[model samples]
Target: MSSQLLPRLAQEDESTDALSGPQTVTRQARPLRFITCGSVDDGKSTLIGRLLWDTKAVKEDQAATLRRDSTGQHNELGLPDFARLLDGLQAEREQGITIDVAYRYFATDRRSFIVADTPGHVQYTRNMATGASTADLAVLLVDARAGILEQTRRHATIAALMGIRQFVLAVNKIDLAHYDEAGFQAIAREFREIALSLGVRQITAIPVSALKGENIVLRGDDVMPWYSGPTLVETLEKATQRTGQSTGFRLPVQRVSRPGEGFRGYQGTVAGGSIKPGDSVVVLPSGVEANVKAIVTYDLVRNAAVSGDAITLVLDRPVDISRGDMIAAIDQRPQTGRAFTARLVALSPDGIVPGKRYWLKAGSRRQRVMVRPVSALDLATGNWDDAAVLALNGIGVVELDFEEDAIFDAYETNRETGAFILIDPDTLNTVAGGMIDSRRSRSGRFDALPDADRASITLPARLIEAFLKTEFARAHVGEIRVTRGEKE
Candidate 1:
């Protein structure tokens, strides 16, 4: 949104915790995954870095190095190494900005986190889409001084488009802006309106100073006195993790765990719901059915495993199951098809053109697809206009006609199974990210509108006659043409 320049700061001390044992109660539990996106220099990296440092998620040596390498010479005068915290790449280090999706891991007492620090620059929107696609929640940072900028709006709109409605709108850098109540409220109001317009109902705006380590992991006494809400860390811990509910159990069988050492089983994270031993399963896109003989983890045998658990499964009868086949519950089998329609954001500069071929990736399954552009919407203006091609950051609707069939649910029904991305076959770079709008049923109701009645009701009789005459002539059928001549 706002073009906030990178300011060189004097060096500062970044205190951190010593890495210890597993932080959460759930044994071998996976961390909550989230992506941060907003205007340039909105302090996304700094916020996350602070959270990790305060929560003892960072290793001691790494934290020490980060502190030593901070911007300025004196600890008090030095600027925090916020950008360097997540910009682990050499190129990013040299550029002093996040270039791609920099993934990092951290943990707290209540939960662990896989933070995808996405780039805020408008040019690198594709990277943002990749990071946000798998996120359970989107944390949007807004500079208190600048308020809601274009990039912030664009990121929020994209997150919503990608089926992410939960947002933590961090009004960051409040210290620099003097923690002005009016400034914080102004920015919050602006972003609230934008988030609401973009269909985000649950957004919590917190005034935070990521640089000063205020209201991030630990609540600060310096911010707005009127505000009384959970700090960023508290809020994140309280947020519910996303998982789809279905009677059907699905695991996009990754690879038959190479029958090594008397072990021939399917290895994959449960894509949706839970699966147990003795449950009837169906391998979809192939329509083969089998009963689960055993749900095996590496160490112990599990009667049931929930979604997100990576384990190998054994079936009673050997069936033709492969990498792409979706192993779902027999009774509640998900819809499987070769073609599907979706709302997509074209990530490339050349844009998405109709009848263009791209590699479609859903879960672990891949297919060559021909995208038929149904329509294109301008992200900045929300205008639905048709174009031969959709450019970078262009949001629109498209129908992906795939060469092979695969199982998928609606995004609203299940985000994990309902989302997908398009990749360039040549470059192998992702070109677009999409969400399947589940509201529309299989029937084509919108396309089957009573156009004749609508036209007659809306148009004048003279214009309707002219339209009918034009259509009849176009049809080239000899008929009783009741026109103005018959009336006369």
Candidate 2:
């Protein structure tokens, strides 16, 4: 694969007319990215291993090693342990549990797939979120013997919050349930209710036996004739890719490139909308306006570029531009403020500390911010509870106070520009992944002032004198004015 900064196109569009010329051919759909998650011992690894085995993704040498590893163990059908194919680590092999996220790739005649096998242990929930963050769909496994567990609900909630709209409830180990159709139905119905509560409408529940190779890549007509639905592979091949953002143009400048003294260009991927030559653009924060002179790419000079295309942008006039400054359409600009509210998943062991200063990185910008937790999400009951701090694997709402003006959009509107991550300054480790909820003004009085009269507004002498005595005023105060009414 090319190591380009361009985003991958979800799908290609093709059209043809009989009178015009020869028929146009449709391009192959991009590989579908999906994740398999549930509670520990839920057979997640087995399901993925079976899928790879049946699809001929495993080589002969790998199969021989699996047989050797399972010399003393075999399923009822005389098949070697399927989990061995994925549990590559020595610790994982000995414990028979996944500790880290394992990614595997396979393909069918119609389409291709990239699947992530995530850990189910409660402590590894953060690892699961890391896998699901980029997945377009999720495959949630449930043991037929044990219907729905707390971890099952937790994974579902996190997947939905990460913007995965498509779900597949795999009721695995069906053979252990005597292939009872009622048991499968009950589990499927319960999961559907949970999915519905999360505003997820697209879901498909299927009965599967990963150990016996039933209803994975092939139908289990011999065992359960009642299931007339498609196999797991079929559902995946027919699923659709997640749609991109429909918002206006946004390009967060990554770097400034000057190959020669007279040439200057801004380099970054188009995060949203399309851009073309002569289009009016604005440099945010500074509010400098300019027109596009040209669009430059490694391949050729293009007239237009859409979302996901990485290209260099040349402006018609010289203006101050640098990394982290956004180049956006003049008419539709993102929110700019000093404070904002957000929802984040706490990933570090120390969790998110209240009133602690950390580095908040969004797009290409990184700035100092203080985080305060307001509420914690109860994944089991789908309710928010009062919280002062977020623990490991905890999800909560927080208030972020920034030292400088920040730009963003609501995550529900455009994920590319609305998502951010918090880094611990001391350790330089990522502590949380957050989504922008809304913007909040730092100075309420300043925002309430009329735009036309802001220049004439003045502070009271008493208030100014008292403020100047404080440490915050000494560090942040730039200008002070005293207002006095005319003496009568």
TM-score of each: 0.76, 0.84
List candidate 2 segments past 4 Å from native: 1-27, 441-461, 464-488
Candidate 1 — worst ten consecutive residues by lDDT sum?
A: 13-22
Clash totals for all candidate models: 10, 0
Please give the CA lDDT of all the candidate structures.
0.74, 0.84
Q: Give the TM-score of candidate 2.
A: 0.84
Q: Could you give me the TM-score of model 1 versus the true structure?
A: 0.76
Off by over 4 Å in 1: 1-30, 56-60, 71-79, 108-111, 218-223, 256-267, 296-302, 382-388, 438-488
RMSD in order of candidates: 11.3, 8.5
Among these predictions, the greatest TM-score belongs to 2
